[model samples]
Target: MVMKVLFAGTPEVALPSLELLAGDREHFEVVSVLTRPDAPSGRGRRLMPSPVKEAALRLGLPVLESDPSDPSFPDVVKATGARYAAVVAYGRILRQPVLDALEGGWYNLHFSLLPQWRGAAPVQRSIWSGDTVTGATVFRLTKGMDEGPILSQSTVEIGPDENAGQLLDRLAQDGSRLLAASLEAVGEGRARLVPQSPGAYEVARKITGEDAHIRFDVPAFAADRQIRACTPEPGAWCLLHAEGGRDDTGLVLHVLRARPLPADDRAAPRDLPAGRLARTKRQVWVGTKSNPLELLEVKPAGKKAMKAADWARGARLADDAWCG
Candidate 1:
């Protein structure tokens, strides 16, 4: 018996699960795809369809667009006669009525294990906090944000140097398989629900522009985590002064890739201030409280990303020049 499922998602991270559910016709049938309306994108500000919408249209599935907050959304979903709804990065909070409309309820493929990182921007928050391990969760959707009973989950180790974008790509692929297995169990009436322990989880809130600036007063490793978490999105940036010590007139350089230097490698002269810029023949290093960070890649404002060594050579930075 094939269970009809309504799919809701937007963005590239949700693509794998959407495709998986649509292709598994024997066990589940995608009744319709609901995504946000087209929005402006790129330098031209042209309206563009979401990745999920594009994928659904390519597969000949009906697509619906509307704000989930609209009171009539439950009716709209109920009209589809979908036995279940699967949501992955849908970017909206569903109301109680909407939750009740689907006969089998909604199953969400969250990027982090709930009740941890339950809000928006889970992948980014996990990396920002220097978590050693993170995973995906398939859970029953409720009124509260990510406060749902778990259907299934799969864990993955967080690589030391992994950034938010790289980690999300891996989790998206792994999550699709977990979602599929959970769906099968639900369909066969053999699925188990595990309630999350109260007061045992941390929240993963959205990232803001203020969070992207690198602070040199903190430990080098913390600064490294900030750089990786902010990369590929609101990039981590610092102001760089010329060798002549004109702090008032400096260039803002976005740090795209960086790593912390070991304790021995960070030993510097007592007079060297934090945010000081130093360079070896092949690499660019910046001072922090505990140690210095080696800049592997960087982008000057309004310029393309390039190797830090290349940028340093082009700028003709003096040995004593500093950045903050």
Candidate 2:
């Protein structure tokens, strides 16, 4: 007996899971897709459909546009008569009515391990926290936010130089497979739900432009985390003094990659007077508080991203310029 399934997701992460459902069409039917309303984009500000909604349309499935908090959402899902609902990166909370509408239960594909990082921005939070290992979880959805019972999980080792965007892409692929297996378990009556243990949980709050500023006074390692966390979105940048001793300019310096320098080599730019450009043949290292950040790649304001070595060669970086 095939189980009718309703898939609700938004964003690139949701695409892989949707593909998995499409592949296993024999066991599940994606009755309809629920996505956020279209929004204006690009320089022209033309309205654009979401990737999820577009995929749903290509598959000839009905696409519903409604806020999760709207009174009509539960009714829409109920009309589908789907036995199960798969929620992934949906960007909206599922109320009790939507959860109860499913015959079996609502399963969520979360980017982080259950009970750990459960909230708005799991992937970004995990990278910022410097977790050596992180993974995805398929859990039985509950009234609480990501505070549901876990069914299965798969771990991914964090690479030394991986950023939030890169790591999230990998996690999304893993999550697709994991979600498929979890659905199989549910179909076969072998689904096991594990409730989260009571303790302090780290919430993944939405990152803001204010959160992306790199503070030079902080330890270089701390600054490195913020740089990785805000990549491909609100970039992490340091304020730099433009030429002619004019007012300070907001230089959008994107740290493409970096690593913690040796303890003995750590030097704060303030320790020296100012305007310092510490460099090496391969990479130009920037001194912050306590430690030095080896800038593997950087994008200066109004410029294309280039290697630190290239930037160092082209720009006349004073030995004390980087100090500020």
TM-score of each: 0.94, 0.90
lDDT of each residue in 1-324, candidate 2, tens digit only: 576788888787799998789768777788778888898988999999989988888888888887778788778788987888888988877789878877889999999987899998888899899898999999999888898899999999987777888999999998999998899889889999898888998899989888877666667777678788888667766655433243556355666666666677544223422223466566676666666777777788779899878877877665545534
Error of 1 at 235 (Å): 2.0
Candidate 2 backbone collisions, by pair: 274-320, 275-320, 275-321, 276-319, 276-320, 276-321, 276-322, 277-319
Prediction 2 TM-score vs. true? 0.90
Candidate 1 on 68-115: residue-level lDDT in tens? Answer: 789888999988879899999989888899899998989999999788
Runs in model 2 with CA error above 4 Å? 242-246, 263-276, 280-282
RMSD of 1: 1.9
Off by over 4 Å in 1: 243-249, 266-272
Weakest ten-residue segment in model 2 by summed lDDT: 267-276
How many clashes show up in model 2? 8
Report, for every candidate in turn, its global Cα lDDT versus the true structure: 0.88, 0.79
